[model samples]
Target: MGLITPIGFFSIVQKPSDRTHDTLTVRARMRGDLAALK
Candidate 1:
């Protein structure tokens, strides 16, 4: 069906986005800690 391609693409795209989102969150937290330390 036509819907299958988007579903497959979204699954692939979502994983990396989740990883990047997690990495960004961790970096932000580290930056906050650094600011607090200063």
Candidate 2:
């Protein structure tokens, strides 16, 4: 239980940042594609 607690906390803290990074990356890619299309 003790070891699991830290792992769970780590994942909770990490997930949002990971999601934000992925979102930014996707948006940047989309913008680049739009610019290329123009």
Q: lDDT for model 2, please.
A: 0.34
TM-score for candidate 1, residues paired by index: 0.23
**Which tens-of-lDDT digit does each residue in 1-38 have in candidate 1?**
11223213111133566786664222223344435434
lDDT of 1 at 10: 16
Candidate 1 CA-lDDT value? 0.34
Q: Tell me how far the alpha carbon of residue 36 in candidate 2 is from the true structure, in angstroms, after superposition.
A: 0.2
Clashes of 2: 0
Q: Which lDDT value does model 1 have at 3?
A: 20
Kindly list the per-residue Cα lDDT of model 2 for residues 1-38, writing each as its tens digit: 11233213211133566786764222223344435434
Task: Give the per-residue Cα lDDT of candidate 1 at 6.
Answer: 20
